[model samples]
Target chain A: MTETTIAAPERSRRANLLRTQEGVLFVVLVAIIIGLSLLSDRFLTVNNLLNQTRLFTETALLALPMTLIIISGGIDLSVGSMLAWSAVMLGFSWQLVGLPLPLAVLICLLTGLLGGVINGLLIAYVRVPPLIATLATLAIYRGFSFGISQARSARGFPEEFAFWGQGQVGPFPTQFVILVVLIVIAHLVLSRTGFGRWVYAIGNNEVAARYSGIPVERVKFTLYAASGLMAGLAAFIFTSRVTTTRADAATGLELDVIAAVVLGGTSIFGGSGSIIGTVLGLLIITLLRNGLLLTGVKGDATFMVIGLVLILAVLINNLVRRR
Target chain B: MATQAGRLTQAHRQRGLFAQQEAVIAAAILVMTFVVSLANPDFFSATNLLDIAVNTAYIAVAAAGMTMVIVSGNIDISVGSMLGVCATIAGELARNGTPIPIAFLAAVAAGGLIGAINGALVAYARIPAIVVTLGMLSILRGGLILVTQGRWIESLPEEFFFSQRSTLGVPNPIWVMIAVTILVGLFMKYHRFGRAIYAVGGNAEAARLAGIDPRRVYMFVFVMNGLLVGLAAVLYASRFTAIQSNAGQGFELAVISGAVVGGVSILGGTGTVIGALLGSLLISLIGTASIFLKVSPFWLQAVQGGLILLTVLVDVVRRRRRA
Candidate 1:
């Protein structure tokens, strides 16, 4: 039997930075940045760097929770749909129902939370596999969004809403600032909290975790619910950036989110990953997307490059892990 | 009975469970058809029935392959994109004056090659199936757009219409679907390689000790799946006037959902193509029923999601009762 039958084991107690996965990712990220900068003069500029961060803020937010979900040995394929649903609700509540923008935002967040709760209930309480549960929700949420919006786009949000995505705070994009705060909080929670340990425990072995009284179901439920809430928050930011709420917004976003998390060295089988690693992965992906665009690579070609990166990254990681 | 059912999975008695599940889906389909036809007698029209079967035939064919892949304990989210690529290749070749059968063969061959790459990476390189396919999804999707420049391939040759033609008084698409299903279904039930797929999925190490190479099984299933996707692509493509850039969008969900709903466990090593075809038929029925029931078509996804949830819940309950 290969190790795939079980969760990845604990990290080695002996630390070696250069030998670590994150260290390798950091090196790769630097190399790509240098390569891209040489390819395009615009790539090295501070303005471009700051601007690029805005486009990736939503991915970063979703990646944080996605990392947690994947680390816990579960997946949520519906995050993109949840984001779309929340965005639809935001616009529907604001424009269609004539609610205050702030209230609409709150409702958006609630919709996300509710969506997560549904997943949590199915997975945690009902013991439905996360993949199937989320897949179903993916369709359900997307359908609901389309049904309510009639596949129409909602545009023209108030300036305050726009500020969350595009407005600057002293030189940093507002979304970038928000990402930093959440990133640090996520890091602390993942690295320092008892709940965090429980997450790893459950992923490492759910049966043992249950016997150890780790409240396995609760942890899973909370993780999924939190994933939904974060998706809502990301939807809010995404809507603010685009200044439009459409049911189709964030279509296929789960790929970027999951790609970054996996590239960060998160194990698909569960346990053994880092937020620091995720941030690095996020930076690498964002850089490639922006860098490729700056180098005159059309939007579609960038997908190919990212796809190659995704496959090669894991391929390399697995070969090294085997050694 | 409870004890026997309890040991169903461990003992690998897939037929009993699959038959039970198939019956459930068949009953649901009957109820759904009855309800819809009662609401609108036109739903029972021969033309509409034929139309439904024609449309569902492609999904069913693809799902037959999906059931095998899932049974082998892996997934390919890239199937939809692969189909798009196959269809593009077929159309491009046909437009270039290649013989229609040869063009279709080339498309299927291209699909097989892509599947081989995916399989090699998963089996040899040890990348997670989901991650690899996720990457492939991006590559193919982006690559297709880059090649086609967001344009649909139209004015296909008259002889290229695969779905419209018939043999022995049955529509060609339906014949293809049924033939593929029967061949694969028989292969799965009686072939040594097919049994190897289950053995590998159930316990790779044990299968290895028993002289079965898990790697070969992995490769075979992926390539086989790709071929089916290619066949499905051409079938679906020929029915429409143009092969759109967004061809096969959201298709993976329908195929995978059908497999799971048909009682093929995502956990691997258990399930049947017959059940998967039934599951796909059930889903397509819901989609068709929506049109006749006069509800928003978008609600189709919600129903699909709900049905998946309900099916999974039932499986869980059944497992619990046996315990």
Candidate 2:
């Protein structure tokens, strides 16, 4: 209930360092890295590590906003679908409809914005619950993705288009670099601004926050649109990397992003979580996946581990709180 | 005395609201029936009706359980994965020469076991139901693929396709859906445990103070959900000659949306199986209506999503008017 938890000052921050989820997860993440390094030589390599980061850049993009969304006591289950829809539209417009690639990308981002705004309008203005509103969009967008593309993938984009997806920026994947930059921005926005405080306030108690003169509807509306915009950018990165845009792109991705955020110790009920925690959570998941693949585990099998980790993370959080 | 009478009337009107939801859904079903019959005159043929019923059967059954979970103030995003797991179990067992009935029962039992895990975590570990189920969703989905390696079960005894046959001129699948809906619907209405679920969802602390064990209620709803999922799995799995490991992917969305569209509030505490079943029927009709109308089947998902949003919008508007 203290302001310190939301925007920790240096002194109080240090005091709660050991008790915070970020601290525990940092220790756990280090232990995992070391343990995986021991288990597989390939696991500790810079190439593999960056490769892992590159793999999740798109979803990590989503986790960034998801932290805010959950902290605001709302959820957007349509992000994966948003990614697919945007990706599909990006491809469809450019390849099928003969639009310029740059314009196509703009359309993609616009589609994402439009979808998010609709979700926000439904939830904030119409008072539809977040879960139900997003669920509807999840289907509608994915369907449009498939239908617009006529169920076929769009491929063979201009050569320059691949740079954002497959290009490297001094040993860092381009997408990861973009992700890191966004992470910092999201971090500042979430922890160091009145807007961020409003998100936490809304999460803790929407009615109370509203009575206290916060613009609850505007904040929620903006967050959802932000989510959609992020999903749109992710869609671009994902399609560029894979060099293909299919309706099924990023299928089940919402699960992975959610798993990472929740595993980072964000309360699903909202109001408490940090960008650092989400980043570490994302790192742990990506590392475990890469390590498992190195250790002869199939990529998909890591989903089982992630699922267990997601649950165990919350379990540990509950235990810590009780203590 | 005046306030007492007013309070009684208010309660009566509240009950009437739920009845209104059911009536609205039934009306939708009637309207859809007319549309289908008008568009495809042969749609009412016994054969065509049975085919449609078969499709609606599993969805309605699953949504009925989903209705219970939502009414109890929780959700199970793992429904699709659980259904996949259960169906795979049934298929794998039958392929291993197990009795058809035993395989079906084992699938159902496995569902209950998984549900119990979800319940236990949500109840005892103090994990949010969404997180617990999301974890289960990942675990089951990943584990199923890991175990099956995306293989399909092709060979099966004739008796394994129990749902494909007609009984007393009605396909067995219709019978299964109807029986499950009837039983679940009645239990939810008249049973003490059912009413307790409503109390717990409406307010857990109030229910606990009023002598209801909310934990037990949570467990019961989840477990019951699992059992219904089992039945749904067996029925769904029986329809295909080749049981793909990925069966039921994205199915939870359909089922949950069906329940919500049928009138179950995502925030919980109210909805009925009859409404849910009718909602499922309505969805099935829309899907078929597209094909019958010569619209691309791809538009079905968008229609479903749009319908959910439309229904929720109506619900929200009506509730606002009442307030």
Candidate 3:
């Protein structure tokens, strides 16, 4: 009771730390950075690094909540659609309703939260499976986006609004700054809050968590809402950067976000993950794309390289874990 | 004891009744087909029906394999991309004067190799099926692009086109579909290996205890899926007379949707070849109907999304009532 039990916990904790999938991901990230730097002089340049960081900001923002949701054992297949829908809402609020820029941003985020809440309620409370529920919402939200936007793009936003996407703080892009702040906030919420503990507990074992008096449903619901909120924020940055909003904006983006999260060592079955790993994962993805572009890879070939890297990363992670 | 026995018998009868309820979905599908035919006289034309069958054949074949894979508790979103890769290989071979049979074999083998990689990662490496396959999707697409240098290969030998051409008063693609359906149906119903798939899907832990290697079973399913997808790719390339990296873009959604509508559960462990075939037919008909009914082509994705949602809802309701 004195020595054996105390030593057991410490040993297991160390094992957990060493055995994490993120350990492999971190190694892969470092390896890729080194390899790419060697492969291309441009890859290590400060300008390219900044561009890579900016490129990843929107995707990283979306992946933060996605990490939480997946950790809770659910998926948000609708995030891509949610991004488009949120953007459309923001566009409408700005161009049609003539709302203030801040108010438009608020509405966009609110729309995303509402979408996430609906997904959460349906999956958590109504007992619908996550994939199906989110798949449905993906269509609904995308359809709504198209309906509202009439399959057209909304553009010509105020300069101040677009500044969020393009402006920089010191040497860092605004989007990059936004992503860093968001990641910090997310890291705090996930690591320090009771809600975070509940999420992990629920993902590990929902019945046991429920039996232990945790509000499993509420936590799950809030996680999904958080996912939506992040998606909304992503839309803001994506549209701002692109300087246009279309119904099909962010089409197929959910897969990329999910891929990054998974590559970052997040388990699809949920229960354990970290925002830091996701941040690294996003950086790895951005770097891969940028490096490929610098190397003159184009179109689908770039996707192929990224895909190979993802498979190799996960495979190595799995092999390491087994050993 | 007598009261308990009576209650048990009542419960058994209730279960039997519920099993019969699934047939209602089949009936609904039939009724819809009839109504659709009534709405458009052209729909009942033998030529149009044949067109539908021919169009459905490739997807149906792929969906058959996908159904088994999904029922065994995995997925292959890369089928679309795999198809693209396979088609490129076959087209490249055929263009170089390879015999049709050998080219077809080469394509299928290429797909199988890709699938084997997926199998290795998911089974031996213990990676999640979705992430592995999602990566495969991109990898295959990228490989295809690199191989063709983003150019469409439009020239193929005349024999390559014969697969889509009619023979014996039946479209060759439809004939291939039928042959595949019969063979797969027989295999699923009687083969020991096939039975293992159901056992694994039904309960992996129990199957493992019963001496089945769930990983091996999953490997077989993934490989078989890849082979079937290759076959589909052959048909696709033959029909279109062109192979490009983007040829199978969004094909995964169509095939998965077909499987879902055919009564395959996305969660896996339940589905049928016949159901998948029917689901393929339903989906094919929808696409055809959209064209015949002059609905905007833009709405195709939205409508398909709606149908997927409806199918999942039906599955959920059926499962709930059974419980």
* Tens-digit lDDT track of model 2 for B134-196: 999989988998999988989888989988888998889889888988998899888888878
Kindly indicate the candidate among 1 and 3 with the higher TM-score: 1
CA displacement after TM-score superposition, residue A231 of candidate 3 (Å): 1.5
> Model 2, B276: alpha-carbon shift in Å?
1.0
lDDT of 2 by residue, A1-323 (tens): 58656745743753374247888999999999999999998889878888887788998999999999999999999999999999999998899899999999999898888888888888888888898899999999988887888789999887888888899899888988998999999999987899998998999899999999999999999999999998899999998899999998888888888888888877789877888889999999988888888999876778899899889988988997899
> If both were scored by TM-score, which would come out higher, candidate 1 or candidate 2?
2
How many clashes does each candidate structure show, in the order listed? 0, 0, 0
DockQ of each: 0.74, 0.83, 0.53
lDDT of 3 at B150: 78
By the DockQ metric, which is better: model 2 or model 3? 2
DockQ of model 3 vs. true complex: 0.53
Best by DockQ: 2
Candidate 2 segments whose C-alpha is farther than 4 A from its true place: A1-19, B1-19
lDDT by residue (A44-102, candidate 3, tens digit) is: 98888987776777778889999999988889999999999999999988888899878
Could you give the interface RMSD of each candidate, to one decimal? 1.2, 0.9, 2.0
Residues A287-319, candidate 1, lDDT per residue (tens digit)? 998898887878877888889998898888787
